[model samples]
Target chain A: MSITEIIIISLIKIVIVLGITLITVAYLVYFERKIAAWAQNRIGPNRVGWQGILQPFADVFKLLLKEDIVPERANRIVHAIAPMIALFVAFTTYAVIPIGPNVNIFGYDISLVVADVNMGVLYVLALTSLGVYAITFAGWSSGSKYSLLGGIRSSAQMISYEISMGFSIGGVLLLAESLRPIDIVNSQTNLWNAIVQPIGFITFVVSAFAETNRLPFDLPEAEPELVGGFHTEYSSMKFAGFFLAEYANMVIASAMIVTLYLGGWHLPFEQSLGLSGIWLTVAQIASFFVKMGAMLFFFIWVRWSIPRFRYDQLMNLGWKVMFPLSLINIIWVAAIIMIFN
Target chain B: MSQTSNSLKKRKKDLTFWQKIYIPEIAKGLALTFKNMVRPKFTMEYPEEKFIPPPSYRGRPVLVLEETGEERCVACGLCSRVCPALAIEVQAAETEREKERYPEKFEINMLRCIFCGLCEEVCPEEAIVMSKDYELAFTNREDAIYGKDKLLTPVSQLEDRIEFLRKYK
Candidate 1:
């Protein structure tokens, strides 16, 4: 492909991915509310549209019309930039996650992912670490006690959990022998990483929940204790920015979990079925989405069922339990490779 | 201090291997919620389906307008005297009808009315009864002070509440 062609293709891919991520994020909020209501045995929002399908649009309009309040004591520039940083980190991390194998499109070979860098896994970890800065900055810049405390809690929680998260990925890296996401997905063709190393799977998932600031680890945004937490002083579309970023991060987390552990787009015993070409590619892509959707549902399910962990309990779980378990997982994976290879 | 530490250890030891892990307990909770998710919801879907309160429900106090277009109230001032919140105000005036006195002006300040049904209970003529009109909203204090026109309901409409009051009171 020529320079211009490559540029055009990359631009098209970026638009498609961004559009999909945004729409999914919007509906994810709607589903979160609906599922929460269902858990409590009450009919959720059905007034906006049929079964409240248009509830997200209504929410967006409501947020857009609200007054954007900034505290007199706030650090204006940093407060303004915090949610932007959050949104940037959430969207950019989606670039390395491959949805399907390379397909010949109009006689040009095209990979499904936007960018297929060799160190994609490292890139993801680095970007997600940067996400903590967004919350911390928002908390500190808000000039409110609640926001500051939330920021402090978020940074501590994320930093602690990221250790176990990294070690859990270490087990996958040891097995795949490549930091590239596509290579990792390709490695788990027969037996998924989840089946081979259950301990790593469990730890990685728990860490993912903590990393995304979902419930059970949502101590930073604990309403009763910290009010609105890091976003306490935020209002209008700026607050919506944080809201969008949180859900977008969830999409990325579930996608990462699917790619690393559940064998990405590959289906078990697919070769024995003797499928070929476009049909096979389509099936594989569908499988990828199905797995990702199941993971998303599981995220929502666990949220409504489990209560938030106490701060001391959270720290203990991260350090005393999760960190050691992830290390043990790495050793276990190494033993498996030694026996098999 | 030793006893406290010992009790803590015993509490820690009480949890079996599975309970300590928490995965199974979490799963059990998840299953319970999932079952509830599929079960019938209890939402009333107000506006589409209005709730018909039983006769005993004390909603909003209203004056009964008899079929002959005269109010059942003879302006005896009993309800106004018994009102704990001082919500009811009635001024008696001479009338040519056999029920010689009528309220020239009767007003109930809904803002002050606690829905305690004291006015209804103290009515000598069964004049004021609580009706099933609970949807009361007003933008200003003046609008909240319901006059005679807003407070009056046809006697046919208030039969359920009046019947309940007769049987129980």
Candidate 2:
């Protein structure tokens, strides 16, 4: 392929990924409200448009119209850049995730993923780790004690959880014997990694929740304590950036979980269906999205179901429970590989 | 050798292996929420679909206007005095009707009214009863001080509450 062709294809892929992600992020917020209301047996946002379908757009408009207030004592540059960095990290991590296998369109082989890097998994982990800076910067720049505390807590929490997360991923890497996401997905042909390494899966899922700063693990932005957390001084579309980034991060996390553990895009016994090449590819892609949707639903469901963990409890779980558990998972995976192979 | 009584000791049992894992417990919680997701939602879509409060439901206090277009209040000053928040203001005037005294100017400052049901309970002539008018939105303070027009509800409308007060009170 020519350089122009490559650029065009890359541009197209980027647009497709970003477009889907933004739309999903918007609807995720809408569904989060709906699901929360359902759990509490109350009607959520239904007045905006046809059962509050346009609520996300309405929220964006409201945020855009609001006054962008920066605190007098705040570091204006850092405060402004924090959410942008978050948005960048959250969105960029999706570039390497293979939503579906390679497909041939118009006799040209087109990979569903944008950038199929050799170290795709590492890229995702590194980018997600960079997300810590966004929160920490927001906290420090806000010039509020609340924001600073939130930032500090998040940094500590993210660092603690990332250890378990990294170790958990170590098990998957052992099985796949590759750092690439596509290879990881391909390795889990019949039995998923989730079934094989249940402990690792559980630890990874828990750590993902913590990494995303979701409920139960959301000590950094514990609303009652931190009073809006790191984004206390943020207003207008800047705040919306963080909001968008958070939901986008959820989408990416769900996708990663799907790709890593849930057998991304490849349905069990799908090969025996005797379908055409195009149709099979389509089915696989659809399968990937379906799994992602389910994972996202689980995320929202768990959020509403479980109350936030205390700071001490969170630390204890990370260190005493998750860390040791993940380490044990590595041993378990090693044992299975040695015995079976 | 002192013998310790086992009966008086507090049992501090450790968590079992399964409980220590916590997955089963978390699964139980997830299942509970999942079940609730499909259950009959008790959401009353307000404004579009107004909630019909039960007969016992105490809403805004309203003056009962009989079919004769005359209020049931005889300006006894009982309801005004009984209002804990001092929300009611009644000025009695001489009338040609069988009830010689009638409230020429009756007002209830809903801002002050605590919806305590005291005025409804203390009504001597069954004049003032709480009606199912919970939507009390006012733009300003003056609008919130409900006058005779705003406070008065037809006897037909307040029938459920009046009957309920009679049955229970």
Candidate 3:
């Protein structure tokens, strides 16, 4: 491809990914509410549209119209930039998560990812770590005690969990021998990383929940203690920015989980079925979405089922349990590699 | 320190190996909620489907209107006197009818009405009773102060409450 062609293709991919991520984030909120209501044996929102399908748009409009209040003591510039940082971190991390193998489109070969970078895994880790700054800045700049406390809790929680998360990924990188996301997915063709190293999968998932600030690990946004936590002082579209970023992060987390552990778009037993060309590519892509959807559902289901962990318990679990488990997982993977290779 | 710690001590049940692992326990909880997700929802979807409150329910208070279009209240001030919230006002006037007296002006300030059933309980005439009209909304104080016209319910519509009162009260 020429320079212009490559630029156009990359732009098209970026637009598509952004659009899909935004739409999915909106619907994910709707489904989260619906699933929560279902878990409690009550009807969820249904007034906006059929089974509340259009509720997300209504929510966006409502948020857009709300007054953006800034506190008298607030650091205005940092407060304004916090949500933007969150959104940027969330959306940019989705760039390297390959959803499908290369496919032929109008005689042009195209890969189904926004940017196929060499150190995609490292990029994702770096960007997600930057997400901590978004919350911390929001908390500190808000000039509210609740926001500050939330920021402090979030910084602590994220740093601790990220350790286990990194180690868990270490097991996968050991087998794949590449930091590239596409290469990791390709390595899982024979057996998914989840099956090979169950401990790492579990630790990674728990860390992902903590990283995304989902319930059971949502100590930062502990409603009772810290009110809206890091977002206590935020309102209107700025608040919605944080909300969108959280869900978008969830999408990225699940996509990364899929890419690293669940074999990405490679359907098992596809060789025996003898699917070829365009049909095979289509099936593979669909399979990737199905895996992602299931993971997303599990995330929602767990949120409603489990209560938030106490701060002390959370720290203990991260350090005492998850860290050790992930380390063991690395050793287990090394053993498997030694035996097999 | 030991005494205080002993006082604050909890009887903690030691978890088995499987329970301590946490995964199986979490799976059990997930399974339970999944079952509930498929179970019948209890939501009434208000406005579309109204709840038929049981006769025992204490909602807004109403005066019973007889079949002959006469009010069952014989200018009784007992309800007004017994109301803890001082929500009800009744002005008695001489009447040519067999009851000999009737409420000339009756007003219930719903804003002050606590729905305690005190007015209903104190009514000797079985005239005032709690109705199932719980959906009360008002823009102003004047609108919230329900007059005799707003308070009166037909005898047939109030049969459930009256019968319940007769058997239980």
Candidate 4:
């Protein structure tokens, strides 16, 4: 494809992906509420639309109409930039995720992915690490002691977990023998890495929770104590940006899980399913979504079922426990691979 | 010997750097939490699933009547006088033919009633008592101010007591 053609295709893909992500994020909130209500034997949002499915849209409308307030003493530039950075980094990670294989579009062959980089895993890791900057900036720029403390705590928590996260991915990289996500899936032709690298899988799952600031590890934004945490000063679209980033991060994390461990888009024993055309690509995209939805549900389940951890306990878990276990897992995996080879 | 003993006391068994790392403990904690997340939640579904109130629970106040269709209260005004919260108000009227005292009007401001059950305890003839109607919610102030007719129990339930009172007299 020519430069212009590639640019046009990329823009189109971006628009489609972003539109779907925004809509999905809205529904994910509604889904979370419904699941929570079901678990608690209460009626969740049912008045807005059919079974309250439109409730998240209604919420978005309300948030958009609400006043955007900036504190007088706050650093306005950083305050505005923080959530955008978070949201941008989150959305950017989706570029390399292969929803499906190649297909013929208007007599031209096109891949479903936006960018198929050799360092897809590293790119995702980089984007996820950058997500902390937004939180930290929001906290420090707010000029409030609470926001500052929250930012510091969030950065510390994320950094601690990131180490273990890197180690977990190291195991997957070793098993796959390639840093490219597509290659990783291709490597898992016989069985998913999840079966072989159970310990690494556990580490990755737990680290993902901490990295995204989900419940149990969601102490940085603990409402009762921090009073809105790092984004306490943000309002209107800026606040919504942070909200979008959170849900988007959740989506990205789910995608990573599907890609890394669940054998991304590779259905087992499907050598003759005739999924080579557009239909195959569509099915792959659908499978990716199903896997993501399951992971997202698991995220919500953990959130509603458990209480937030204390800051000390969270730090203890990340540094003292998860870090060492990941290291041990790495060693174990290396030993096994060596012995088998 | 003294120096050796001091050294021994000072050389406390500090956790090895590896033990201090806490990876296994966190794994255990994660397992426990994950197990809890999958476990069945204990939830109480309200409305359709009602909770059984305790036996001694005091609810709304109701008035009692005699079998001869006479109000059980003889207008002694004891319930009104003894009520610490002064929630109950009673007025007496002399019957034209019998020249006997009967309550002309009875009103209980539930808004003011502290639900101490003092009025029911103080009723000399057991004429007033609290009933098991705790689902008492009102949209208006007027609705909350329960008067004589609304405060009284159904006539069918009071009929037996009223008949017994008439037979004894």
Q: How many Å off is the CA of B54 in candidate 1?
A: 1.9
lDDT of 4 by residue, B1-169 (tens): 9999878666544655554544565556546655654566555456667765543556777787655666677777988888888888899888765638878888888888888777767777778766666787889888878887887675565444345434543
Give lDDT tens digits, candidate 2, residues A1-341.
Answer: 99999899999999999999999999999999999998888768998999999999999999999999999999999999999999999999999999898888877789899999999999999999999999999999999999999999999999999999999999999999999889999999888999999999999999999999999888888899999899888899999999999999999999999998999888989878998878888899999999999999999999988999999889999999999999999999999999998
What digit string (tens of lDDT, one per residue) describes model 2 on residues B28-143?
A: 99999989888888977766888888998888998999999988899999989999899999999996768898899999998999999998898889999988878889889988
Better of 2 and 3 by DockQ: 3
lDDT of 3 by residue, A49-73 (tens): 8888999999999999999999999
Q: List the residue pairs that clash in candidate 4.
A: A320-B21, A320-B22, A321-B22, A321-B23, B66-B162, B67-B162, B67-B163
Give the CA lDDT, 0 to 100, for residue B164 in model 3: 98
Q: After best superposition, candidate 3 residue A172: deviation in angstroms? A: 1.0
Which residue runs of candidate 2 sit more than 4 Å off their true CA positions? B1-12, B95-98, B149-152
Clashing pairs in 1: none
Give the fraction of reference interface contacts each candidate recovers: 0.85, 0.71, 0.94, 0.03
Which candidate achieves the best lDDT against the true structure? 1
- Give the lDDT of residue A311 in candidate 1: 95
Top DockQ: which candidate number? 3
Return the TM-score for candidate 1, rounded to 2 decimals.
Answer: 0.95
lDDT of each: 0.95, 0.92, 0.94, 0.82
For each candidate in turn, the interface RMSD (Å) is: 0.5, 0.9, 0.5, 5.2
lDDT of 3 by residue, B1-169 (tens): 9986665453234556788788999999999999999999999988989999999999999999999999999877998999899999999999776789899999999999999999898888999999999999999988999999999999999998999999999
**Which docking class does model 1 fall in?**
high
- Lowest-scoring 10 consecutive residues by lDDT in candidate 3 chain A? A269-278
Model 4, residue A298: distance off in Å is: 2.3
